[model samples]
Target: MRRVIVIPARLSSTRLKEKPLTIIVDKPLIRWVVEGCLKTGEEVILATDSERIADTVKDLNVKVVYTPSELPSGSDRVAYALRDERVDHVINYQGDEPFVYTEDIKRLFKALEDFPVATLACRDTEFYKDPASVKVVIAEDGTALYFSRSSIPFMKLHSDLYPLKHVGIYAFRKEVLLEFTSWGQGHLERLESLEQLRLLEKGLKIKVLLTDNYYHGVDTEDDVKVVSERLLKKLSNPTTNW
Candidate 1:
């Protein structure tokens, strides 16, 4: 199936203003995200509402699609940007995910063949208590049951369950994406402040691909520092294993 990756970038971030343009380790945060997506060898596009962000990646060898600044969510921006495209699948990759793994993206793409939508998750105990890290619970067949900013499947006693941190990246079939955008905001989605919950509330099945790779998204000034240190470490040691 024909597939393309779209990174939605907005300038007026509530947490950190101009987050996409924020410099991290000598490179713009959006550039790092775009470069990471490009590593998957898929056609990657940047969908943005800001001219500054669009111009930032002008020479990055990737196409930039402009959408209205009033779009409610990243998914809406992506749908609007690719409204006329004939592509079979669209990957709504968040512009702040600088550490997104190419292999994890590939896995999500493959999973899309069996399900209309697919996303990535990683098992990490440290993030269980951290509400900033979204968690997901999956069914036996790998279909996601729920996504929440709080820890799920609360272990009252000793158990083998580990919190699966939901990665922000998403892959959607073109038709499903269009349908999703058409649906109005869901109650659960608004309550949790999580867009993916809208899909679940609508009874749409989303396949969750378990991966080992963790992503560090740039949300605030502190996040920039954390990502910068990670990038610097990688650059300093080329052979350093992840």
Candidate 2:
């Protein structure tokens, strides 16, 4: 099946100002995201509301589309971009997420063979209390039961595996994405301020893929500092050792 990566970026961020255009190392943050997706050798389309954000990746081998600045969320932006394209599967790669692993991208697309929606998660208890970090609880079959910004499962029992830190990356079948964007926001989604909950509220199963790979998105000044260090390591290294 035909697969692609669509990155949604906007300059008007609530937390960080001009997040997409923020420079990390020598290149813009959006450029880092685009280049990593390009390294996967898959077709990448950058959906953005800013011409300046679109201009940063102009020399790269990727397609850029302009969407309305009023678009609600990144997923909506991705869906809007793919409206004219003939794509079967797509990964809504967030622009702030600079770290991209080709193997993880492949796994998410491969999961579309069985699931309508799939996303990545990893074991991390550190962010359990951090409202900025979303947590997911999965059923026995590896399907997500719920996604929340609050601490889940209550941790009454001692275990190292309960709270799973949800990575923002998502892969969706094209039709599923179209329908997802069309649906109205749900109560839980509004409460948590997470878009993915809208899907769960609609009774659509979301497959959760767990990985040990380090994935982080830039959202604050501290994130920029931390991500810059790691990104530099990745770019400076000739091999994939970072």
Candidate 3:
């Protein structure tokens, strides 16, 4: 049961230019993600298209695989990178996401024991109205009902769980990934421009694990400032767990 964390980083980003190379605090954003994933003691593979992106983490103890820059999604980049690897499970850790928790990672992989696809979410009202932050609505059994860029489950009554901030990190069984990447883009996926929607449209159940841990993916200029302060604070306060 081998599990590997594959991080896909691209040089270009529509929201934030050179997102992977953007420096969060004292290090590059990609480096922060790489270092955190390394702490988990799992085989970490960095799937990137830029030499500049790969060079940032050149010193790290991680396998760097270069994929085509034209790959449509992060999931595709990882799948391309891992084409020759002998592994049972793969975690598509978004490069823009700087926050990485070991326990949360373990839980994601553990879910694949029963679920074909699994992801993370937390109760963050901060992302409720923010379109950049995709929101998710889950069923009673914890499987996702839908994910949308627009605010979902319109809270006329207001429940704490009504709005769950979808964490982009996804854990996929190797076979499931093969199936996902092979499918054509779905209607909802094309409209919303979210790759995960393609899975739900195809009747693939997505198990979303709720976590209290902090996760902030750098998307816009504002996120950089927020994450920089948070990273600096974490570095200063050795005991502070983010």
Number of the candidate with higher TM-score, 2 or 3: 3
Residues 1-242, candidate 1, lDDT per residue (tens digit)? Answer: 67999999988899998899899988888988888888889998899988899887787778888899899999999999889988998899999988867787788788888899998888888778888889999999989999998878696775565678888889999999999999988999999899998899999999988887657788879888888888898889977745
Score each candidate by Cα lDDT.
Answer: 0.87, 0.93, 0.92
Model 3 CA deviation exceeding 4 Å by range? none
Model 2 has an lDDT value of: 0.93
Full ranking by lDDT? 2, 3, 1
**RMSD in angstroms, candidate 1?**
1.2
Q: What TM-score do all the candidates reach, one by one? A: 0.96, 0.96, 0.97
Clashes by residue pair, model 1: none
User: Measured by TM-score, how close is model 3 to the native structure?
Assistant: 0.97
Residue 177 CA displacement from its true place in model 3, Å:
0.7
Q: Per-residue lDDT for 57-86 in model 3, tens only?
A: 999999999999899889899899888889
